[model samples]
Target chain A: MKTLLITLTIALASLSALAQGVKVGDKAPDFNLKNVDGKMVALSDYKDAKGAVVIFTCNHCPYAQAYEQRIIDLHKTYAAKGYPVIAINPNDPAVQPQDSYELMQQRAKDKGYSFAYLFDEGQLVYPKYGATKTPHVYLIQKRGADFMVEYIGTIDDNYKDAAAVKEKYLADAIDALIKGDKPTLVNTKAIGCSIKVKK
Target chain B: MKRFVIYMLLVAAVAASCTRGERPTGELAVPIVDYSGLEPYLNKSNDTTYIVNFWATWCTPCVEELPYLEKLSREYSNGPVKVLLVNLDFPKYYDSRLLPFLKEHDITAQVIMLDDSDTNTWINKISPEWQGSIPATVIYRGTKRQFFERAFTYEELVEIVEEF
Candidate 1:
């Protein structure tokens, strides 16, 4: 009985810790989430690419709105260079109606989004990635058939004005990776709207 | 009687002018500060429990929970609880968005605007557990501090403050 109780306690502790989600150097989880185009997109679909710039964002967040153009610019600049931005909407539509799939399709069409705007139906993908807010970024690199999380955080230092940005953290990390060097900064933080979910 | 009437008129004119002078210009002034300026509020060594909420005008959850914070402030006004709302709205929207929201919501709690662009540094300093999400709160009484990365209801807030 004593041994069983100890095992149960450890298991519960680790389960709670797992709720925090993935970290740097961990193998990134792949999902077949539905895209705005009605096709299912998966990380494995980008097997030929060097890495993927995965960003959790939605339509209603002001912070996400601020970075929308920047995200488009990132895909424009880096997609050809082998890192494509895979945008995901991880909010439950019931919690936030504006982030519903129909609006997501409309927003993508209106904005002319250059990348896949996938919806994490049932809200599964973000919890594995430990995404707490919209505009959270996770840069994953392909390493011997495994996608390893290289960097996790925001797009840059200045979310409000991209022109006035001093530190391009995401760009710098991608640049270092292309040059076959480790990123000096592996993680960062920025204020964003919390990922909406129902109780 | 004529002298008395003249003196009364002069007094009324002076009173009206003073009232006009004291009237607010309709422009709400919220102090803007960097992370350095905000650090002192987070680390006060006093007996009063300070509930510092990091929020913005645009964040939905933050806006949704503002009334609870206001209620908490109102209930604890004469007590040792001090609620400080730290707003993170963009500087460009200060006039266009933030002020209007503040006015519309009738937020009477002490508000301070945080204008720092270096979020990576200050975010960790606020709390390592915070992953840079708004609607996050820090309730502290001197060195005994608790950080919440989620929104709170009035009852939950009251329970926490009571314990503090």
Candidate 2:
């Protein structure tokens, strides 16, 4: 019976590893990544902010490109409100040369991105957040000592058209947290370009 | 003389219809579909092994692997396997972009357009492992099924499908 119990525990542990990344209600992992402006940025840097909008986006993805203006608008709308957008390029530059750090700076400059576009140099942070695709978003609310993952998923209901979007999942989640209430919907999904990783 | 004119008109109509039968270069008839329409194909049980690959034109890696997928589709034509190329391109751009891109690429495999908007609902339902990203694939023969969420080379794709 003891041996059987040990085997079961091992199996469960491996299963959790296979599941990958933090689930709902799990504390968000903190990371220090180089921003486009050549400064290292981390979640803890926004200590006074109510929440953070961490989006795994890249320079090459058309879906990410489509939502670029919307993401910029999100930052312009919410930055002063204390929910700053933190864009990260989680794709491997080896796999996708367009997403290289030098190109990221150029893109940010050309687009006039108000937010800090960070480079996940070794591609470590995204897997911890369970981000499988470019433009995957995670809305985190700062609690006493840890950042609580309030919402995980897409920026809005529509990726094809920003004008026709009825449901703003990311904005709604942030709004709820600012009002000191839990978001009604904590998760959503959209079709996005899978993160390019080297074979 | 009037009867002869009528006969000539009929012949011209028949000739036009025959020439029109030829598609615009490499264009294939790709139907736009929702989950209800696609669910039947995925769940239907049969001896024929169905290799359904979910992809889009904008997805770089997916486009990179297309030639390999097409080659495999051609190779397995004689076997009990059918490659269904399910494109998840945005519905609005079907005519302007997706169809033209299909024609340009000369995609010979049977292509179907997936027009579902609520990806969160269907991605998980397709396979719990899917996090709504492309290009993913589902291969099935009868009740046995396998889901892969990674890119494949020509050799790798053939090996996986052959085992199925």
Candidate 3:
């Protein structure tokens, strides 16, 4: 009986590691990445809210910086409606000093960002989400027994010039989920700086 | 009481570790992903056409152009044409970041992590007329190598591959 318990414990540990990251059908990886305010936030903590929008973002990267105001606008528009936006910075600070935790805190404060700007320590959370871009967006939902990814892609249709945005991909997803409808687009072709995952 | 104590300890440990947040995340400690081994092909090789492309992690145009090269590599599966995708991404970024990006893109070409930091040594080795901008493609056939610095649509990629 003791041997069986030991084997079960080991098996459970490995399973947990493998399943710790997010996938299409799997429950989104619950995390405690620190926000810009030095506060810790978890995906589970946002559970009672309608849904969550986690964006892998950074302080630098022209593409990300370009979308900064829109991201803030998104938080203002969605946080009150349940699908609050939670931004995660994945850039390594050793390579890009601009992305350091302190800078992240400073940038968040400067930008007046109302959302959770969390950090993915050692970049341990990026691969699970398969996040590749600075502005990679993920829409998460919980219907019955599990949490699942609702959408992933660019913040919108325009990047070179924000004034040219024709389709608001993120806004549409949040609006759909809020109205009790399945998001029309789940996966989109992304364009931005490739996420710089740290070791 | 004992079980509750164990559970509390587990949660505390997890919370402590998870709260550390993102460490400096640009480049990471990666296996030396050097392209020196493939230098011969670029320097003294006699392949009819050598298609060399420069790419990096932060460039969107580079990613957009990759699949075209991948498709070309597959279509010319029975040919002698060589497509070498030289990633200019720093080594640290290669291990921690580029691999995941490649995996996401479904890239299937002869993708190589070119360890060329000193731009002086390599910038001239590839071509004197070349500027180190991404989405730049060079097609070499025997003594000839043609370079293009723009995204290739499907038809354009096929034409370039055929010409090479």
TM-score of each: 0.88, 0.84, 0.54
Using Cα atoms, each model's DockQ against the true complex is 0.68, 0.54, 0.03
State the displacement of the C-alpha of residue B20, model 3, in Å, after optimal TM-score superposition: 49
Q: Which 10 residues in a row give candidate 2 chain A its minimum summed lDDT?
A: A15-24
Kindly give the stretch of ten consecutive residues in candidate 3 chain B with the minimal lDDT sum: B26-35
Model 3 DockQ, alpha carbons vs. true complex:
0.03
Instruction: Kindly list the per-residue Cα lDDT of model 3 for residues A1-199, writing each as its tens digit.
Output: 9999999999999788565545555567767888877788988777677778889889877668878999898888888888788899987887677889999999999989889999887887887876755787888886654457888766776554568777777799888888888778665543356555432
Q: Scoring only chain A, what TM-score does candidate 2 earn?
A: 0.92
Instruction: Give per-residue CA lDDT, model 2, range B1-164, as digits (tens).
Output: 99999999999999998865444555448876788778888986878888899998888888988888888889988777788999987776777778778889888999999887667678877888777789999999888989988778999988987877
Candidate with best TM-score: 1
Reference contacts reproduced by model 1: 0.85
* Chain A TM-score for each of the predictions: 0.93, 0.92, 0.84
Runs in model 1 deviating more than 4 A are A1-19, B1-28
Which digits, one per residue and each the tens of the lDDT, describe model 1 over residues B23-131?
2666447777899989998999978999999999878788889999999999898778899999998888776787789899989999999999889989999999899
Best model per DockQ = 1
Clashing pairs in 1: none
By the lDDT metric, which is better: model 2 or model 3? Answer: 2
lDDT of model 3 at residue A120?
Answer: 83
